[model samples]
Target: MPPPQPRTHKAKPPSPEPRPSSSILLISPENKILLLHRVKTSSSFASAHVFPGGNLSSQDGPIPAPSSPERHVDSPVYRLGAIRECFEESGILLARHRDGGGMLEVPDAERERARRAIHSGEEKFSEWVKKMGGVVDADALLPFTRWITPTSVPRRFTTQMYVYFWPLSGAGQDAKIPIGGDAMIPTPTSDGGLEHTAAVFQSCATWLEQARRNEIIMFPPQFYLMWLLGKFFEEGKGGAMELRVQREKVKEFLKGSGANGVPWADKVMSPVPLGMFEGRAVLNLDHPGPELKGSGRRGESGHVVQVRFSKEGPRDVEVRDAVEMKRLMGEAKGKL
Candidate 1:
């Protein structure tokens, strides 16, 4: 054999720096919360459930404020991004009147102008709020939670979660209302862009039940929030009025000791847990439809065939082959 060649070491590739993400959470005046169902066509996390929020933009930076808000402004970028996303995704503007009444009302014309400004890229949120006689009510937004996507994930966000309550009106209820609306009256809609396909109202109990039963697909933040909400409901004597009080307590709770217990930490384990699978099944079956195979079918298609094992017994047979005749017959009769 020839003399062994000298070993050569290969240089390791450089590790990529982490990217940050941000988001906002809005609860309507009706006590119904808002969430987004990501479109199946999305390039990132397609078909996954999410909130009405997004990553921070370059324009998301400090605005001159006469007084410092409750949140940190050193990175006003994150706050600004959160406010912008709240508007973009949920039609809830975390802004106040120039006089400081903490109310949001814009006429049709003004609403249109603001929308135009945002669309044209000429309107910065801070400047627009100031010009339109409004202030960024970052104080009203409660910093509920924060999350950093795991490094293993292809896409990530250093998301800051905020919760805010907004007034509801007929115009606000209009799902087609444009963001910022026209000057006559602010028309807030649930059409929160492609990132959100549907927005609906449900109580914390309802949300938890759905999540627990796997009726809805939610990410960590959403899942955690729902679990926390469930605890609040549980603590509230299981009544709507008590639940409302518990809802208000959330802001204080977040600022103090954080949620009583993080459900994700306590509940989520093993990538493929029974809870997650059950949730998936529930979400899949949410709509009106036939039950799954093992659940039993209804109607004329419910017939079952019985097979007898003879003395020749115990021969292995493929179910697919056995079902082929039945399948073909069903197809021929248009019963499949």
Candidate 2:
């Protein structure tokens, strides 16, 4: 028998660098935001209902200098990726006619075909838009916030969150606007049930209630953003009034938050795990992470999220306000 070879342990590969990605909160005119349900077997955010987003591609084009000192170095790339992903995953193309006539009007059949071609790499997104004689309406995306995945995760992404108020003007006769109005809006549909299972526009509060009741899983970022948005549109507002009021209110917020044309302003969040509360993990929403010390970016303090993780995925998310978060943390520290 051959002598046993000396045992040698293989060294672990280095963790991947955080990829630049973008997510869009597609705020409908009806005071709701579009959410896509990821398949349960997804590599990231498995089984979670999340905003439309994906990693940037080389076809997204070269990164420009920060739009302002407050914007990330890759802000332009992020914006492009956000628009492409939103269209690929949700069938809502954010672009306009090349001659600046108005929004690009494509039949649903053509839209679906183009979406498949772009998503499958048969053609680049930019090239496809140009082929259709349109320019991406990236300017319509308003910077909402940015989130860097925690270091503990094996795969990480620096995702820029954007708010896009879908315009319902100049729709073709074949458009499907769920609301009772005659105005036509781009219909949202899943990408052939591949990456996402469903694409639906539902109110923030309704989504929050669903997550709270364990009907769907939402990661902390989605949960936190929805919690913030829920504060603006209450439940009792009437139909069209709710839409108009919410649109104006959100526009005001974006204008106020994104003062001086700096992306995200002070709303960069890098959650740091402080401890566990009950069976859930408690994270410090305000921490800028060790890598970002002295970066000057800050999240709203005194707010925390409790999320439970299982082998399946993250579930049971709860965002605690200042008072409740203080009580929870104080009790954990034996100071309450």
Candidate number with greatest lDDT: 2
TM-score of model number 1: 0.60
Tens digit per residue, CA lDDT, model 1, 1-336:
999999989996442322344566566544446666667677665655566677666577643332333122224566677777666654556777878454655554565556556644688877877876778877666665455443344564445566666633323322233322221123344453546676565566676456544455555446555555545544325344554576667655555542223321111111111111111211110111111113221111111112222232211111112244345545655742
Off by over 4 Å in 2: 1-15, 63-74, 178-180, 236-242, 257-264
Clashes of each: 23, 0
TM-score of 2: 0.86
Residues 63-179 of candidate 2: C-alpha lDDT, one tens digit per residue = 432233423433667888999999999988888889976777777788889899888888899888888888998988887877877777888876788888766445532556655
lDDT of each: 0.48, 0.77
Looking at model 2, report the run of 10 residues with the lowest lDDT sum: 65-74
- Where does candidate 2 clash, by residue pair? none
TM-score of each: 0.60, 0.86
The reply for model 1, stretches above 4 Å from the true place, is 1-15, 62-75, 108-120, 167-193, 233-244, 258-336
